[model samples]
Target: MKMTRFLATGVSVALVLAIPNIVTAKPEVQGQVDFFGGDGVLRSAEFDARIDNSGAAEGRMIFIDPSAAAESDPDGPGEAVAGAQGLLIDADFDCLVVTNNRAVMSGVIVDSNTPERIGRRILVTVEDNGRGRRSPPRRLTWGIYPNQARNWTPTDGELGFDPGAGTSWLASDAEREDDVPVPSNRSEAVSCDSFPPGSHTLVDIGRDDGNIRVRP
Candidate 1:
């Protein structure tokens, strides 16, 4: 009876440790996205996540809104160019699916500068191409005019169009005028070869090499 008890205890402890490994054995993705200097308004995001089937994520997802520079006055003091409007969304991730070259993740916003954005959901996709320029550098790199172009680098210097992965997002649902439903019951440890079908908005490209990653 003592031997049986010892065996059961050992098995229980082993299972306990193994369960955590299983949970974390899934996919993990993290990266920064800057869609500014491109077309449209400045809509960028950053995230790091690895969630389970519960669909409730414990990570980070911050989105920035474009707020053209605080218009400057030729005769008045210069205005601050805080690129993005004060729009950052602290969120929890619940899903992370990876394809052969891309990783897709989703999360729900907990707080934000805008009240209507609270409780909304957003999804991001990162494409891994073995590290390279996301897009060729343009005059946007020199900060000259609104040419509707963007690059990974801010100048034509050595870092001009630095190497990094490409990241995109789908915020149509999250950008609604009002709060949206939270996400749940998403699968973990998935794989694919092509990006999921949809109109995803690229965040210009990663500003550096630590944009994002995915296994297989």
Candidate 2:
């Protein structure tokens, strides 16, 4: 009887150890980002993300265009001409996560010619479908003009475009005037390769080139 009881206790302990830990957290998501410039240009990037149950997100954004011209004045021709200098951006970005599928990112732009200027800032907001699979981000906006100061501040006022001002690129005049939803039948699903290849540089996350990491 003593030996049988001991075996039963051992079996119970083994069963407890066999039970797996349940993870109630949301699964990680991966997608592409496309920024529409005021110059009628669209630049692409890659973003892999993990959002917590509370809707907070953490991710990395890798801009495609490493070297592009930085426009200081989007409307003024003289400052625009003078400010047309090659801005080499450091593509890898650690983002500031916002709840409800939004993020703000900033990175340094290396310009040997202009040593006084700082870097650039980008804002991305996407439509959320709770519990359903997340679609590709809808709005990827950036500063059309570069910041003169060392600290990064957005140039929304200088660019004459503000989403909060009801002048967003995604907002139509009717939607702005009436605050009504615009009729659309467009899918948000997009692949990184679907964007124009020449517009930006591409990063292969699978390679060991140190652009991205699974654990990091």
Candidate 3:
């Protein structure tokens, strides 16, 4: 009887340990963005995704917007961004879907109130069409306005704005209004005329302000 009871206890412990792996073995889908594009017709696709109560927290839905380099990938069923590496998706949150001439990006909405959230999002959005017309001709140009140019490192939910860190440029507006889209990652190649005037990497792209670097 004693041996039998010990054996049962061991089996129960083993089963409990295996439960987590079994639950996660299956990709618990939370949500998905579906669209259909074929031939020359570009139809607007409807987005759909849902959460599985049985799945773990890590099983949240993910919509990776690949960079322009691999937008039209002809691989088996897989997640990808237009030309970027990948993007993580989160439900119960508002997001921004930007459509430029070269790429399409669906940026997760971020409240600028938090600092770690800045660079938390990746900068996977890349334009294959030569980054548009060289900032055009203007007495005062805002290098990569709205979208952060470079040198901006986002952590947690806040961003490090550095004007002199990359090829991007920045301008100060006493009466600036609007929200800036944050990227999950940034590119290495920067344009000298892309950043604003400063040496800080932490900046609020939504507002015209100075840049500051964070101490890790």
- Which pairs of residues have clashing backbones in candidate 1? 57-93, 99-192, 100-192
Rank order (by TM-score, best first): 1, 2, 3
Q: Which scores higher on TM-score, 1 or 3?
A: 1
lDDT of 1 by residue, 87-200 (tens): 556766655665565666655667766544555555556665555456432111111111122333333455647443333333436567676443332223221212352334
lDDT of 3 by residue, 81-132 (tens): 3433333333221221122311112233243222222333322121122212
* Global Cα lDDT for candidate 2: 0.41
Evaluate model 1: give its TM-score.
0.45
lDDT value, residue 105 of candidate 3: 21
**Model 1: how far residue 171 lies from native, Å:** 30
Better candidate by lDDT, 1 or 3: 1
Local distance difference test, each candidate? 0.51, 0.41, 0.29
Of the pair 1 and 2, which is ahead by lDDT? Answer: 1
